[model samples]
Target chain A: MKPYELTISQAHERLKQKELSAVELTRSVLDRIHAVENRVNAYITIDEKLALDQAEIADGLIARDNMTPLTGIPLAIKDLICTKGLRTTCASRILENFVPPYDATVIEKLKSAGTVIVGKVNMDEFAMGSSTENSGIKITHNPWDLTRSPGGSSGGSAAAVSADMCLGALGSDTGGSIRQPASHCGIVGLKPTYGRVSRYGLVAFASSLDQIGPLTRDVRDCAVMMNVISGHDAKDSTSVPKSVPNYLDFLNGDLKNTVVGIPREYQSARGLDSDVADAVTNAIQTIESMGARCVEVSLPHTEYAVAAYYVIAPSEASSNLARYDGVKYGFRDRDKSDLLDMYRSSRSKGFGPEVQRRILLGTFSLSSGYYDAYYRKASQVRTRIMEDFKQAFEKCDVLLSPVAPTPAFPIGENADDPLTIYLSDIFTISANLAGIPGLSVPCGFSSGGLPIGLQIMGPHFSEGQLLKTAWHFEQAIGIQDRKPEIGS
Target chain B: MKITPEEVIHVANLARLDLDEAVVEKVSHQMGAILEYIDKLNEVDTSHVQPTTHAIFLTNAFRDDLVHEHLERNQALCNAPQRDETCFLVPRIIG
Candidate 1:
């Protein structure tokens, strides 16, 4: 296999054996990026000189035998994560030229691990939409099928990894942003427990629901990344102070005592494509044959998840995104003569339609006479959703379900109907609402050849167990080697 | 309609977003549909439940008052759309 095609573990092995240098690997990936980027459009920015320089530094570290697993690895970052000196757009024109003054805590951690920073990738503008078509920058096509979306708002991150544009990527999940894209792109994506990873530098989409995690070609690579990026940070107070376990230790590939919960509600969920349901059924059988037990568990509040999420996410987003007013560090409307007019014009012109829609929805929900009915009601429903998970977890070690209701649809399939896109996230949004970790592993392919992902979720800080369960399933399936055909 | 164009305009003003007439019409329809869907929350009897603003229980984080290195004035002002040597310049707020 070419160097760009190697997973993080494989690249690490070759680098350790002196069979490859970090510089060569970085160069190979850069070349692959240049060759296929026109078709994939996975990246918003590419700083080759900076990436090569970091790889050179990695080579020195490797030569001294002082290196972590990620040392010398090339990784893509979701544009929302702050990388000092690199323009972090968040796929919104408002911050199109805004460069963060400092690295996010995760970026700092990755840099210390000696990973080469490839560049920022696109996302739905401010992470407001289910597809990257909301990106104010560029649309990232699915590597599996160019006409289909690489499900988003982490579309570019998934597309980058799936197309071999980068070894691994960091994508933040507010509501299935990471896992859904990984599902569509046929890779492994993890949304760690809400406080498992610090959000100090992630451009806030919805403060209480957002978490940063890894998207990689395999479960092991995801674990490798988790080891480096997970843990408490003084910078982000919401980050848990709990100690992080070495996630790699959990990937024993043994499923002998595991109990998997198959959500009864999920089986009968509306809009669940038959192809996806069949794939997940086969996945359950594969796990069951490996000496694991599967039980039917009911999360009765499942139907209300999208409703609660749409309200809560947009509410928090309205508050969190209020800082952009053309005054401090984003787009400005110079022609406006007054301050309020300037704020209005700058935001109106800077934000995309989806973003505007969300801001309006959030503002409406929080406005006087509406707060109790919308925001408060959603919060109450959120409490119910969390309780449902708590009760379900009492019966099973992990919950298994399809990541998305279906494989990736065509690019513009649900663009005009925001409500339709919101409904599609029903399967994955509950995890974010309940503050649990979720893993999406490639389960099978649709008859149309699009990928389907099986989501494995566990209680808060249960990433180790989730990773182990996913690893076992991956090993049994032996489909991680499949690659999208991005012709030369 | 669940929400009217006038309501959209009112909320847009509250959010400090300047939506033109066409966008106001479009957003009014879209927001109306979304709100109608969100109305599904009313189906649950949450009368006795405590609202959950955050998923995880967290206490307020306290830190020492000791001075620490922070963004330099230049770094802080670096990305400003309009800035002087030290301050971000904005449209006049005072008469």
Candidate 2:
């Protein structure tokens, strides 16, 4: 097998035994990236020289008896996270040529741990769509079926990991950006409980809902990457101060007493793909057979989650995205007169159509005349949605649901119908709204052979439980070892 | 709850985005459809509910206010399309 096929743990062992040198592994992965990246549209830029330099440094560290969890691993970063001197576009034209001068908190952590960053992966232009078709640059296709999308705004990251372009990837989940794509691409994506990971330096989408997380091939690697990236950063005031746990250790604990909740409301009779529904149901049965209990719980306000998220996300986006006004940062039109004209011309030429639509929706919601009727009302509904999750959690330790309504859909399938695009995130948005941790893992395959994923959500900082439940289900179903045909 | 073309134009102005009339007309219809679908929230009795702004309860992630100087000004403006010696250059702001 090629070095890129090894799990992070296996890679680490190989590195220690001198069976694989960082340079060799990095080169192998780089070669794989060169082979498949164009077809997948996974990378906006590939810093071959920089990645090789980092791998050399990691080799030196290992030679000196210094090793970290991420040492010598090749990782991809979603374009949204700013890396000093690297062009961070967020797949939008507004920042088309913008290069950040400082590393985001996540980048700083990755560098410290000796992780070799291969490149910036593509995302939805400002994270506005479920399919990467919204990328202003280009669309990322699913490795499972090239005709379908790899999902977005972290589509490129998912596609990269699924295609083994990198050992893992860092993606920011504003609303199902990470988990949904992970589901579509058949990989593990975890949105750590809000504040478990820092948001500093992540280009703000919705300040309160966005989080940086890992996309990898397995759950243990997710936990390991989570340990490396999770923690308080003085730069980000929103990051929490809780002590980080050894997530890998927690996975070995007994799960005989685990309780999984099946939210009755999520089992929609309409609009849900029958294959996905069956996959989730079968997953629950598998978990139940392992001496765990599955209880039917209700998130009564499940319907309001999408509505609330759309309002609150856009409102925050309107405020947060205001930074790019053709003045201090990003694109500036060369032929404009007056400040207003400059602002108008730069933004008009810079932003994509979907981004413009979102900005408008957000501005209107926060406008003086409409604030009470829209933004405020949405906030109130957001509270009810949180309450529904809280109430359901009281009945079970973790909530199980499908990560997306279906598996990967054909590219441009929902491009014209924006409402249908928004509904694609229905199952995963509530976790972001509640500020809790949610993970997506491959469960079974659709009849068409595309992968289906089941999500396990836990209360804030209950990542250990979430991982344990997912691990238990993974063991029971015995699907963790299966590889996709894309690479094989 | 329906959004109209005039409202889209107004919001576009506030956002500083120059949308063509046809784009505005298309988006206005789409936005109206979405709003009408979400209007089902009005039927739910939420009068007694409290609003949730942040999911986590912690507040005030305060940091020292000391100045932490960053990238040189030139580096910050390196990506700008047009720039002068000291600042990013834009179209003349005055008539």
Measured over all alpha carbons after superposition, the RMSD of each candidate to the real structure, in angstroms, is: 0.8, 1.5
Q: Write the per-residue lDDT of candidate 2 for residues A1-488, one digit (tens) a residue.
A: 79988778789889878799889989999999888877888999889999999999999998887988789999999999999988899998888877888899889999999989999999999887788888999888898898999998899999999989999999989899999999999899999989888888899999999999999998888988998999988877778899998898777766678888998889972488999999999988888888888889999888888888888998999888888887877878767767887888888888888887788888988997988778888889988888888888888999999999888999877767888889878899999899999999999999999989999999889988888888776766675544666553
Q: Candidate 1 chain A: worst 10 consecutive residues by lDDT? A: A479-488
Q: Report how far residue A23 has shifted in candidate 2, in Å.
A: 0.5
Docking class of 2: medium
* lDDT of the candidates, in the order given: 0.94, 0.87
Q: What's the lDDT for residue A218 in model 2?
A: 87
Local error of candidate 2 at A324, Å? 1.6
Model 2's alpha-carbon lDDT is: 0.87
Q: Which stretches of candidate 2 lie over 4 Å from their true place?
A: A479-481
lDDT value, residue A58 of candidate 1:
99
lDDT of 1 by residue, A1-488 (tens): 89999999999999999899999999999999999999999999999999999999999999999989999999999999999999999999999999999999999999999999999999999987778999999999999999999989999999999999999999999999999999999999999999999999999999999999999999999999999999999899999999999999998958888999999999999999999999999999999999889999999999999999999999999999899998888999999989889999999999999988888899898999999999999999999999999999999999999999999999999878999999999999999999999999999999998899999999999999999999988998896456999796
